[model samples]
Target: MAAIPKSTGMQGGAMAEEAADELTLLAERHLVQPWPMSGSIGAEARGRIEGGEGIYVTDAAGRRLIDGPAGMWCVNAGHRRRELAEVMAAQAMELSYNSPWYTTNAPAALLSGRLAGHAPDGLDHVFYTTGGSSAVETALRFMQFANNVKGRGEKKLIVSRQGAYHGSTYLSASLNGRPRDQDWMDGAGEQVVKLTCPNPFRRPEGVAAVAFCDYLVAEFKDVIETVGAERIGAFVAEPVMASGGVIVPPDGYLRRIRELCRQNDILFIADEVVTAFGRLGHVFASQEVFGLDPDMITFAKGVTSGYFPLGGVMIAGRLLEELRRSNHSEAMFAHGLTYSSHPVGCAVALKNLDLLEDGLLEHARSISGHFQSSLKALEELPLVGEVRGMGLMACVECVADRVSNNPLTLDLEVGKRIDNHCQELGLLVRPLINMCVMSPPLTISTSQIDDMAAILRRGIELTMDDLVREGLWRG
Candidate 1:
């Protein structure tokens, strides 16, 4: 990796400041940012990231900050890799566009074969999409199509879990179980059933982790029994819930769920959008890390290291063969995106895969212990209730008190406070309600990890002081 560029006092001085001001004004006037509140819907001006390289990004103010969230948990191979850029440009020059509807491209075909080789046994087919949401939509649609052709059209109900973040598309978003996700938005709630989040930390009071796992499995079994397995089509879950604060389920929880899905004949979809592509030190984590043989696996994000929008579903060959052998074999699934199998995206992904295969995956694995333990030490702080995570991802959950382990109220915005402090000290954090998530680039060194943790420790200490001075927190 290259040495991260140091922060120089705002480049171009007055002119740069004026340009930034102009850009912010322009955005406020015309840009509609995502996940905005009604008050700030179209007028919100977010921090502008000017550029990035290695494990750091330069903000518009010319301050170099550690890319802590790794650009929304993508950018697995780090930023501004010349090789990735060159491959994308070369592929575009060779063959810019090819319609998947009527034609195929070399990059797409070759990449499919390569991805299939990385996927679990029997999952030999791929259906490309623009991103994670569309990939999940494609998987659900395929399940519905498969059941309809087999005369099981009534089996359309989807099962998901609390604290899971699948996607933003309608059907996919409906599967999201976070409380704030559906606060103002409408979804197909009637078609989806959600189970308890398999988080041991928040499990019912007095329940042990081992028993919590059993309770989770038992709850699913009861749902299957009551809803009737015949009415359910798919059970979708993230191996490690990402946006829902890096909720890693109890041991054997996923395998048990897979067994239940198998017994009930429900399609098991592993939404590996965040856990795949070297995030968990593997190309895919469903079977490799969690010991699951899911019927379908949806992946995005790190697929192209966020260099290009690319995501897909890995389908089991047996499922496709079963569809082929059915009487309605000629039926079309009738689903696909215009950018499906995009040559440019595939080319970028191929190069990204090369980087991961070379040594990035090993690097991630080698440093994950340091990455996790460094964050885990933050639990010593009074405001921290828990610091839980696995692999390169982790969450620093803040609470009102340690004994109660109760989350701080929304007004505190503790996570945001920590994030603001961390940013000022040269690190970026993904703030959830009262939690801060950190998943730095895979190339982050042990020393960088030390710097990140040190800055975060100081940030939390500062936040604690602020809260105490405001009379909001005793500690």
Candidate 2:
């Protein structure tokens, strides 16, 4: 590997401007950003975020904006946490890295015990990975491997849901159900089955919320029957579909689905990559918030509060026991990551857990209601179709009108317009086509929540006015 570049100490005014310009030029020339359009594939200069503190980040131009999506829904303890940084430095100095293939580290061993205490019952063992994608990939692969070892190799089909976002790796991305995600990408479609997104706001024309829940459950039943449960290995779902516009499922939907999976002997995998680690005011929301007893749970993002890349799969102890007693007990699972149980990442995570247990988790729980209600009020806006969320995560979806709740055309880019206006007004927004997702740091105060809501309100109003003036939308 090439030697790391030394910082040049560029600070203030012209120096900052010149540094920002050079960075942008370098990115445009050589950087390949995630989820770029084909038109600007390798030559895209997006925004430049220079520094972050607490619930805000400073742009390259020195403008501080509220971190709306909490750095992609991580940063539970917020940015620039001295303790987390200190822990990483101390651990690196003490023992930077250790191979998981043979040697085990202290931090990793300790974190596993702490996490198991917080995880649901039966989920007592963990398999560490590099991040959410790899975590999910590991879970699916484990399911396949376990079944193959048990003489059920045909049970390899994976079931997922619409509007779910798992990861970017080949197998994990294959499980993604978003419309635009697979437009230009090829996946293992034959190995996966998708169910309807249980979004109450977008339920069928005449179905009520209760009926919608039943419909979703019934559909899963039909899928199991039609596909034959013997061929299905696992059913993967997010507790709250994070990137799918924060789509919260209908009441009792997840529980019913869980029951079906249990009855059919299919492994239920809760992909809590975004919801875990205090985002929903819990270390694990499966049993705490959703009443789920999944066979495996995949998590990342907030594990190290985005300070380090770390993720893991919480597996049921009984499952491992079953494997141990099987005839193929001598066979290897044959999967591992170089950074698995990384000493520095685990050290950071241990400290991050300390912060959460001390007070951050309780703080998140206390303010979640206010955060949710504040954004829920945005439904009154003419451009906002609906504002739905749970805990501190929410989405403001813009539509053509209230009567139909139909999305605006792609050309409008309503969400992006709102985000631009919000940025100008000193707030950042995660624009998802026609929706603005807000998931600020868990440390956000009630006063800051008010300011964020006010800015978002004004941003929508401005966008609505722009649309009306442009004759693209009539309100």
Name the lDDT value of residue 283 in candidate 2: 95
Clashing pairs in 2: none
Report how far off residue 354 is in candidate 2 (Å).
0.5
lDDT of 2 by residue, 39-94 (tens): 99989999988899999999876799999999999888899999999999999999
Candidate 1 residue runs with Cα over 4 Å from true position: 1-12, 401-412
Candidate 2 clashes: the total is 0
TM-score of predicted structure 1: 0.96
Displacement of the residue 188 alpha carbon in candidate 1, Å: 0.6
What lDDT tens digits, residue by residue, belong to model 1 across residues 392-472?
Answer: 999998885545455446324788889999999999988888888899999999999999999999999999999899887
Provide the lowest-lDDT 10-residue window in model 2.
1-10
C-alpha RMSD by candidate, in order: 4.3, 2.2
Q: Which stretches in model 2 have alpha-carbon errors above 4 Å?
A: 1-8, 401-412
Error of 1 at 326 (Å): 1.4
